[model samples]
Target chain A: MRTTKVLIVDDEVEFASTLSERLSLRKYDAKAVYCAEDAFAIARSNPPDVVLLDLKIPGMEGTEIGKIIKQFNPAIQIILLTGESENKIISENLGKDISDYIVKPVEIGELTKKIDNAMKEKEKLDHSKGQP
Target chain B: MRIWKKLMVGFGVYVTLAAIIGIFAYVELRTITKRFTVVEVADDITNIILEVRRFEKNFLLYKDDDTFQEIKKYLAVLTDDTDKIRKEIIKEVGTDNYEMMKNAIAEYDFQINILSKNFKLQKEFISKIGVLTRSIEKNLSGDVLNSFLIVRKYEKNLMIYRDKDIYATLINTLNSPKFATAEVNRYRSLINGLFKLYREEQSSIEKIRSKARNIQTFTEDLSKRERANITTILSRSAILLLFAVLTIIILGTAVNIKIANSIATPLKQLEGITKKIATADFSKRIDVRGKDELASLGTAFNQMQDQLQNTMRFLELANEKLRESRAQLVETEKLATLGRFSAGVAHEINNPLAIINEKAGLMKDYIDMSEDFPNKEKFNVMLNAIFDSVRRCSSITHRILGFARKTDITPEAINLNSLVNEVLKFLEKEILYKSIRLELELSEALPVIKSDKIQLQQVFLNIIKNAADAVEEGGLIRISTGIKNNTTFQVSVEDNGYGIPKEMLKNIFEPFFTTKEKGKGTGLGLSISYGIIKKLGGNILVKSEQNKGTTFTVEIPV
Candidate 1:
């Protein structure tokens, strides 16, 4: 079995780093960045199977970053991470390039489960495309 | 009395005085007329006396029948006139003088009669002597006849002139001895007799003249005295009449002035008060005096002024209330806007709180993994405290966002009693923990109103929860629900707690304004409930006294 690669994007550097380290301890390949530009650079150089994106960022919206990363690699799955529990963001971006969403103060176990699920979903799509 | 009655009374008095003056004038005029009549009678008496005196003088000179008749007629006229005005003459000239004048006129008339009888006897003696003298002349001649003729001529001269010398010559001629006959002697005797008769008649005429003069003097004096009396009476009546007229005028004017002042003084006061009322000053009152119409009008005016003052005060109070409510509405709007802005800020703050929470969780995880770490339990405890603080921060942010979010109302029929009971049910545990007395005075007849039930429950829960929290141990909290008015229903929560200070009362509805100790309150309960009530088309009001209690009332339209 291959380890799942997860990218974490957040304006809060400590939150992103701590969450990434926790995911790394849980046996998932995880990286963390503080801005949309670093997130874009990491996505282009070495893309992850799943991305954890904070909705509010410094320059670009997390949704916009999710769309741009999806364009770069269609197999990469996006999960939105936000401090807001309102359903407006989820309903707006749920079926578009986003796999799922979670509110912040992210639990390490829940995040890993979501990342594993996104990787599986990407593998399912890639398998179907390879066969076709 | 009424004003008109007073004027009528004054008029009545004036009429009475005028009548008195008229009567006085009439009596004075009558007295003056009587005096004039007396004076006329006096004048007539004086004229009659003068006419009698003129006739007496004519009779004395001529000794003729016509003159005697004129004197008698004038004396009768004087006697009649004196009798007609007898009382007036007596009043003026005394009774004794009037009677004396009457006697003098009688004496003059008697003497005229005696003189006329003596004149008749002389006429008879003259005729007899003429016959006797002619016989003697025929019987004698020469010297005797010449003497006889001379005697006759002397007799004729004596009769015509009535002189003493002629009488002496006749007597000498008749006494001559040339005719020594018996008939001649008779003629000489007749001449002596005629002389005696003429002497008596002269004495009577003198007595009549003195009497006529006395009567004339008496009548003239009487006339003068009566005229003076008439003049005195006229002047006195004029003075009395003038006094009467002046008294009437002065009295009438005084009465008129008194009545006019009685009426005009109140009217003047009314005018002054009316002017003050026009200026919108209603502080002054009318001093009502009499029971007259003007006094009653003043009383009514005072009542009107009182009403006006009360109405003005009421309007001022209403205006002040309107201004305060308008300012409150503006504050609510500002708070709403602030609430929206704070929601965004709350969301922004949540990000950092999430970071801090994650970091604390990470530290705790590392400490748990390190079995031999120094003071690892203390480190875990500190991290747990940070985690708790983060949890508190997140809860506050969530509440801020809830307050700013647009609420979707699910309108349904709600019983206010049941709603209050439900809120109290939520606060029951806190109430039991504090040993606070919970009193419910819910009205059974409360009508079911159409409102958002969840929002109303949140509002009631917040208010009643505050009441429970505010009270001391075993203190009282009372929840009551009732219909406030025709269009709204009310629910009130009262607690005997340390009430909010007066200075802090205005800011109680502001977000994050709390009197509770740090960490004991998030301060968003009442503000969020206020926003909910406002959104539900209702009002929340609070009343508090320091150290006494606080009561919060929520009024929602039916």
Candidate 2:
């Protein structure tokens, strides 16, 4: 099986670090950053297979970051992770090529399941794009 | 009835009294004037006395039959005048003086009659002497007869003159020696008889004059007394008039004051009550005690005051209720703000908890895959505890998000039983852990209702969760669903637990009204559910009895 490249963007350093480490142990290539700028930088250099984004970031809004990510790489799957269920932000980004959303304090098992679903949906989209 | 009429009536009473007094005074004045008329009769008596004296003098001078008849008429007139005066005096001054005057007039009349008879005798004597002298004339010498004629002339003069000196001169002449003794003796005899009669007649005339004077004096005194009596009467009448006027004034004033007080006292009381009402003290009432207009007004005023007081009390109660409702609204607003705020905070906390949960899972995996690991079981248990707490926290944050999410309804055709089942699935574990028996009595072939699925799900979830919380171990919660006349779906959640107190049941759905302990309840569950159900055009009802159980019934249109 090919390793999944996962990108994490959050302003909370410990949360970003711990989440990235947990994802890496789960046998995926996960990288974490604390701001939207770094997230964009990492995404443009080495495009991720799936992106995990926090609804609240330091400088830029979560929905704007999401738009930027999809614009940069349309094939990259994005999943939203939020400390609070800011329904406005979640629903706004849901239309912007977001694959799924999960309220925070999510169990690892559940997060893994969502990640697998997101990767599958991305592959299907890629296949369809390649056919046309 | 009206204040003006009352006062006018009071004044009218005084005017009537004054008119009465005026009439009495007029009558008294007339009586005094009438008595004065009787006093004027005194003037008639004095005039009669003067006329009687004048006629007497005329009779003495003329010595004719006409004079004599006129003198008699004068005397009768004098007597009549005296009698009239006496009668007047008796009428006015009582009978005591009338009798005295009557005696005086009678004596005067007697004296006048005597005087008249004596005059006649004297006349006869004079005529007889004349005849005797003529018979003796032829028997005397010429010179003696002449002397005799001279003496006779003197005697006639003396008789007419009625003078004593003249009579004496005539006697002396007749007694002279120059005359014959027989001739003198004859004349002297005749003279002696005439002298005696003349003296008696003179005395009687004097007596008549004296009696007339006495009557005149008495009449004058009687007239004076009558004048005095009239004066006395006039003064007394004036005094009585003054007294009557004074009595009328005093009595009128007293009555006027009484009438004014009767009217004014009630008016002042009404004014006082009005002032109290103006100041917002509506309890004061007029205490009038009689059945006049003022009393009736007081009764009406008291009725008005009672109504005003009742209205004021109603207003106060309404204001109190309004304030309580306003307080409730403020609490609802605070809860809304807190719901949003806590949702945000919960989301923020969820991120870190997720991180911890993931890290702990990663550690557990690492320990399980490693060849040699120290304290593996202890690490596994600790990591499991971390996972467990994180999962618990996630449940709480998710539930908070459930309520905080915008409740804008998205309607869909949904089966009521399926919806209720979906909501109960969330609380299945809690029910098992508490050992509570759950029963579902969902009716078969229930039609799908058109409503918001997520909102109804939340409503059912809240009610079922409250039921779970209310029950003890082995308690039963029965959830039933039904189709009501093919138009609506109804769901009832009943729990056999310690029931809600009757007093608090009414307020249970009000914001922040809670029965649970602090930290166990935000008290927003039922309140939010009620609001959502209401917004969805549904109804929720509750029935509970103390120490028995509670039932919440929800109905939504199909």
What is the lDDT for A83 in model 1?
A: 67
Q: Which regions of candidate 1 are displaced past 4 Å?
A: A1-132, B1-41, B65-232, B245-249, B267-280, B286-315, B337-341, B359-379, B404-418, B428-436, B443-459, B470-476, B481-492, B495-517, B526-558
Best by TM-score: 1
List TM-score per model, in order: 0.57, 0.57
lDDT string, candidate 2, B1-558, tens digits: 466676787787778877877887788678657555555555566667777777777765654567667756766775676565455678765787677667767776676677677777777877877777777776776787788778878887877776788788888887788765675687787787788778887787787788778777876776687778778877887887788788778877887788889888989999998998999987678996777888888999899899989899999999987986676566556656866897787666776777677677767777978876678788878888777677767766766676667545688888888888888789889998999998999899887678888778878888999999998899999999987887767899999888899999989987567888765766768877887776665679999987789999997766
Cα displacement (angstroms), candidate 2, residue B284, comes to 1.1
lDDT of each: 0.82, 0.78
Q: Tens digit of lDDT per residue, candidate 1, span B18-54?
A: 8987887788778768767766766776787677667
Q: Please report the candidate that would top lDDT against the real structure.
A: 1
RMSD of each: 10.0, 11.4
